[model samples]
Target chain A: MPYIKIDVTREGVTREQKQKLIAGVTDLITEVLDKDPKLTHVVIQEIELDDWGYAGEQVSVLREKGITAKKQ
Target chain B: MPYIKIDVTREGVTREQKQKLIAGVTDLITEVLDKDPKLTHVVIQEIELDDWGYAGEQVSVLREKGITAKKQ
Candidate 1:
């Protein structure tokens, strides 16, 4: 069994987008690694700006400080 | 910076239990890996019985089939 998780900053994610991701990730795994779709678990995790940090500072704090770097 | 994710089967978990997990996981990462708590990302993912699988069967199906186990 393979467990997959997607972590993203919770700013403007829609339910439809999440659904697409769940399906896309599952299909990709099935095509690439040949894992069964039923056993291939995909989890979407949304993290708050305040809880996400980079360069020794929270994303919220960085935004406040006029820093606009994106995570890819 | 360290990112730790915990995947658990959703059943009878309490909010208080999740809070403790966040704290304990953060502490463990900080102590063991010397990571900053502020940058330490801990995401707890709860999967449904119907969404989880083991030994070529869904957890919900396994439970229905009288198979119970734990994940650690």
Candidate 2:
């Protein structure tokens, strides 16, 4: 069995979006690995900003300092 | 940055157990890949029995049929 897990920063995730991800990821795994969909598993996790850290600081902290927050 | 994800069939998971998993996995990744824990991300997903299938049947169905139900 091929198990696939996807993790994303939780900010603005909607139910419909997650549903689409589940479907798309399943299909991609099946195509790439030639694995049976019946035996494949796909899981998605939405993580809080504070729990995720980058550059030695949590994302929440980085956003507060305006280090990586902006508009183009 | 290294991202680690773990997926398991949800049965009787407890909060304390998941915390241990997060810590242990982070340590393992750091030791193996030489990545900083600050930049390492670990996510755990507990899946429902219905959503996970094996041997061409859902785990719930197998349990119902008394195929893999146990006392061993």
Candidate 3:
């Protein structure tokens, strides 16, 4: 089983959306990686923009540069 | 179910060690967080020193500074 952690901005996403994302990603992983769905484990971390920094740059900085990063 | 993902260096750790760590962490989470062990889902990510970077610095850099950061 592959464990997947998803970090996302939870501001605008609905609870249903979050659930859907988890289910969809789990399904994709099972299909693409040939793993069992029952063995799948997915973790979701909803953090504000400031919580996750990359390459010494805040996510806002990347957004300002027009570089969009998907959270998953 | 609460999903927990562990990111650790796997170089010197044995498979048994990894499994032990997962079980220990899961136990700790359950005890401290009052979560259910049966519902607990843990994922372990073993990444090379280069794949993960933080604060514009590599893990090696942090190790050099002697400010050891624990991976989870």
* Highest TM-score against the true fold, candidate: 1
RMSD of 1: 8.7
Please tell me which model should have the higher lDDT, number 1 or number 2: 1
User: Which residue ranges in model 1 land beyond 4 Å of their true spot?
Assistant: A1-6, A9-72, B70-72
> Per-residue lDDT for B1-37 in model 2, tens only?
8876677777776655666666777777788889878
Q: What is the TM-score of chain A alone in each candidate?
A: 0.84, 0.80, 0.65
True-vs-predicted CA distance for residue B2, candidate 2, Å:
0.7
DockQ numbers for every candidate?
0.09, 0.13, 0.03
The list of candidate 3 runs beyond 4 A from truth reads A54-72, B1-72
TM-score for candidate 2:
0.51
Model 2: colliding residue pairs = none
Worst 10 residues of 3 chain A by lDDT: A9-18
Q: Interface RMSD (C-alpha) of each candidate?
A: 5.9, 4.8, 13.0
Q: Compare candidates 1 and 2 on TM-score and give the better one.
A: 1
lDDT of 3 by residue, B2-52 (tens): 888777643466889878988998899898999989888888877543323
Computed on alpha carbons, the lDDT of every model, listed in order, comes to: 0.76, 0.73, 0.65
Whose TM-score is higher: candidate 1's or candidate 3's?
Answer: 1
Residue-level lDDT for A29 in candidate 3: 78
DockQ, Cα level, model 3: 0.03
Best model per DockQ: 2
